[model samples]
Target chain A: GAGVSQTPSNKVTEKGKYVELRCDPISGHTALYWYRQSLGQGPEFLIYFQGTGAADDSGLPNDRFFAVRPEGSVSTLKIQRTERGDSAVYLCASSLNRDTGELFFGEGSRLTVL
Target chain B: AQSVTQLDSQVPVFEEAPVELRCNYSSSVSVYLFWYVQYPNQGLQLLLKYLSGSTLVKGINGFEAEFNKSQTSFHLRKPSVHISDTAEYFCAVSDMSGGGNKLTFGTGTQLKVEL
Candidate 1:
């Protein structure tokens, strides 16, 4: 693909429901990242993947938020028991490699929890 | 820890007027700085970056930023801005020490270029 792609541009779910957001990074890119942005705030880091392994996940606010990249290309961000506070735009980005290269971001999936 | 601070939360200027968005950072290690623009209903796009050399770095869309190591600041400036340039601008940093692409972003500033 020419750019990073995210599934389900918008997702609305009830409290305590589970949701999964998917991301398809640029072809041959070796790094993937996830971020969350709240209203009137900047995007906050969530997780980073170098291939199939998670190189960094320290930025995740809590264990309820989880992400995985099984084959180093497409990734999924899973949230358990969604809360109203969890409502935000979930952003996915990709880079040429883990060490160097600026990020290319997707349109993002807007999650609204009722 | 790396933290970025955008001095102004909102800035309004007349169309074609020069503008400057302030940004400062605190970090113990060397870092790379970037300026990203987010238009309405869109994701972020890199305007410019300061990786190394030349305190001043030029980016797309006629945007340029200067990295000041002593002041720990990277301020973006443009001689003139258009209505299309009216968008949310973010200042971000990534430490090379981290050896990865983990970015710390500022609170963001809304640039409103009025006619």
Candidate 2:
């Protein structure tokens, strides 16, 4: 697809389970970002990757949340021991570079931790 | 750190009526401002942006916004609206401190355009 692609548009998991969300950015885009949107709230930044290196991961809530962009193309977000509070829509976005303020976002993956 | 505020949680207007959505921001350094629209079950799409140049920026779908540096505000406006314009509008900001393009978004305002 020409836009960012996210897998498992909807996922339902029980608390304490592990989950992994994948994001495939547009080809040639060097900057990828991950955000979480909770009910009635705006999307909050999670992590950002620039060319295979995580430029910033400060937005991550805790150690249980981790992301990796091994090849600078596809990235994955991992959640360990998911809790009910983890339920939200995970959004992935990509930009040509880090400097450009514009970001192309995917439809997002809806995660429901019961 | 940067943050955005959208005072109105929702705006209800009739068809063909003018509408305005307010936005405010707080940041230590200069920043870039943007307005994004999100339809049901879809990701956000850029409606307009204020990078540098002009303060009154025009965007797609007949939407426009004015950047007020002194007030730290970027209010979106449209001369008239249609039913299709009903959607969630988000205001975002990204600081220009060379800290990557990480946007801080407001809670979003749902625009309900009625007939």
Tell me each candidate's RMSD, in Å, in order.
1.1, 0.9
Error of 2 at A106 (Å): 0.4
User: CA lDDT of each candidate?
Assistant: 0.92, 0.94
Q: Could you give candidate 2's per-residue lDDT for residues A1-114 as a string of tens digits?
A: 799999989999999999999999999999999999999999999999999999889899999999999988999999999999999999999999677678999999999999
Q: Write the per-residue lDDT of candidate 1 for residues A1-114, one digit (tens) a residue.
A: 598999989999999999999999999988999999998889999999989999899998999999999988999999999999999999999999665538899999999999
Over B12-56, each residue of candidate 1 has an lDDT whose tens digit, in order, gives 999999999999999999998899899998878889888788999
What is the CAPRI rating of model 1's predicted complex? Answer: medium
lDDT of candidate 2 vs native? Answer: 0.94
Clashing pairs in 2: none
For candidate 1, the per-residue lDDT at B17 reads: 97
Best model number under DockQ: 2
The per-candidate count of clashes, in order, stands at 0, 0
Lowest summed lDDT across 10 adjacent residues in model 2 chain A is found at A95-104
